[model samples]
Target: MLEVCVESVAGIGAAVAGGADRIELCAALAVGGLTPPLSLIRQAASAPIATHLLARPRDGNFRYGAGDAALVAQDITTAAEAGLAGVVIGASDASGRLDADMLAGWVAHARAAGQARGRPLSLTLHRAFDLCPDLFEALETAVHLGFDRILTSGGQPRAADALDTLAALVARADGRIIILPGSGIDTSNVAAILRTGAQEVHASCRSPLGEASEAEQRFGFQNGAALQTDPAKVSALKAMVRRA
Candidate 1:
């Protein structure tokens, strides 16, 4: 399935309309994604589809303290309570390695929340996986912890640029985990990424232009509010994935 990473409210509508198999709802895409507010998650999940939440507390780096980790675990419950389909979480040590122990707790928290709420609790190891001190070792750790997926660019800026490394990751994943290629994914490069043998791909799939609404115009007077819903690009990405 092709998953679109949604950065705004309008992006959510566009993804569903364009037939996105799933969505990763987040905020502050400019600094990577951060946890969206509970109200935002509620509005998005109310769409009656598989909308996942990325429980990132901030941008910048992934190294987190115990307090930060606890916040992440709490967010899993918060998102699941709001009816989100899953969550994307990543934690690392001071030296940039996957903190599997902490992730295990977060995963457990998500599963429990999902069960209590009657929702699915899938977990996507965020790009921090690419920063692990040892890629192969981190891959093993993720699988051992039963992570649902790992979102990576295969150790480069773009998935298409790191096809060779991603292939190795797919192999090393050993069917115990899913390798999801992201970062710089677009219609032009999605087919090629799928050819790399990864089952799923990620993309922001944005349009320079977007649709505006009346309410937005009223409150956005003189603001020149830009539309974040890029329906055309979402459809284009879906078409490209189908052909693949």
Candidate 2:
């Protein structure tokens, strides 16, 4: 399946028009991704494609204290109540191991919330898996946590740069969970990334729109340039996945 990670409502339209199989909805894609507001989540719930909210409450490390964990739990519940297909989440310990206890609680919370809504919530372990000291062990932990998938780059900055490790992860997962390779993936290298045996791939599929207004930049409200999802890129990548 082809999953497009989008930061805006326009992106939802693009993903649907481009025939993407799923959407990983988030905000502030510049800092990786942050949890989207409920307004955006509600909009995504109406999307034609399956949509998963990236339930990250912050921009830094994946470690969560009580307040952070509480916010994440609320986001998961919000996504379920909003009728989105799933949630994407992750956590890690000081030693960079998967925080199994925290993750288990979050999974349970998501499941219970989904049950209350009469729909099962899909769970995706996010890239924090790449931060683990042992990725294979981390994969096992995610499986035990009842995650439907783990999004990773084989512990590398780009999936294309870690084909062997990605393949290893797919092999290790062995259908118990999905190994979805993402990061630095585009039409140029998606073919190679998919050769690693991942059944699904994720990407931003974004192209430069333009810089923010001078005032927006002057006030530090804007960064370098702005970008938006490119439906053509999504279609091209999806076609490649089908061919592969």
Candidate 3:
């Protein structure tokens, strides 16, 4: 099952229409990813979605401070209220090691908070796993703490860059958890990524970010710089995944 996790409303629609199994909603993916708007969550749920929330406030590093963690926890609550399926996120130390205690606490908090109403909970430890000191150790921690999946690029710039590592992670996972290989996965190389043994793939498929419409342009929210995303690329990736 290739889960095409996207970050925008347009991407969400495109994926659902294109037959994606899941979606991870976020904002400002230019900075990796951040919590998306509440309205977006509502919009997604209204469309028969299996929406996973991204609990990141900023990018650049996996580690965050106390305040930041609290913000992430709050975002989890928001997502839960919005009827989302789960959250895709991470929290690590400055050395890129899983801060076991912090992660444990976060895991507990998120588990309790997100499923307060008894809905099924899904938690994916995001690409921060790629930055961990040891992939095997990190996998153990996620499994011990009951995460549903671990998303990574095999600790490299892209899947191709770390095919061996991705394979190692998948083998280490060994059915106890899911190793979802993501990052730089597109139509040209999705089959190769699948060959690395990832059960699911992640991608933000949509066109370059541009203004919503003339109305938004008139209101001054339009910007010239288009964000990088394209539905065609997403569908292509899906095709490769299916073929694989």
Q: By TM-score, who's the top model here?
A: 2
lDDT of 3 by residue, 1-244 (tens): 6676666677787887776778888887767788887888788776675888888887678788888888888877877787888888788887788877777877887778766868866889988888887888989999998899998888886877888888888888899999888777777677777887887988766565554677766776764555644656656776767777
Decreasing TM-score order of the candidates: 2, 1, 3
Comparing 2 and 3 by lDDT, which wins? 2
Per-candidate TM equals: 0.90, 0.98, 0.88
Please list the C-alpha lDDT of all candidates, in the order they appear.
0.84, 0.94, 0.79
Top candidate by lDDT: 2
The TM-score of predicted model 1 comes to 0.90
TM-score of predicted model 2? 0.98
State the lDDT of candidate 1 residue by residue for 27-110, as single tens digits. 877677899887788889787568888998877888888888888988888887777778899988877888878888887888
Colliding pairs, model 1? none
User: What is the model-wide C-alpha lDDT for candidate 1?
Assistant: 0.84
Model 3, residue 28: what's the lDDT? 78
Error of 3 at 155 (Å): 0.2
Clash pairs for candidate 3: 206-229, 206-230, 207-229, 207-230, 209-227
Q: What CA RMSD would you report for each candidate? A: 3.9, 0.8, 3.2
**Residue 131 shift from truth in candidate 3, angstroms:** 1.4
Per-residue error for 219 in candidate 3, Å, reads 15
Question: Over 4 Å off in model 3, which ranges?
Answer: 209-225
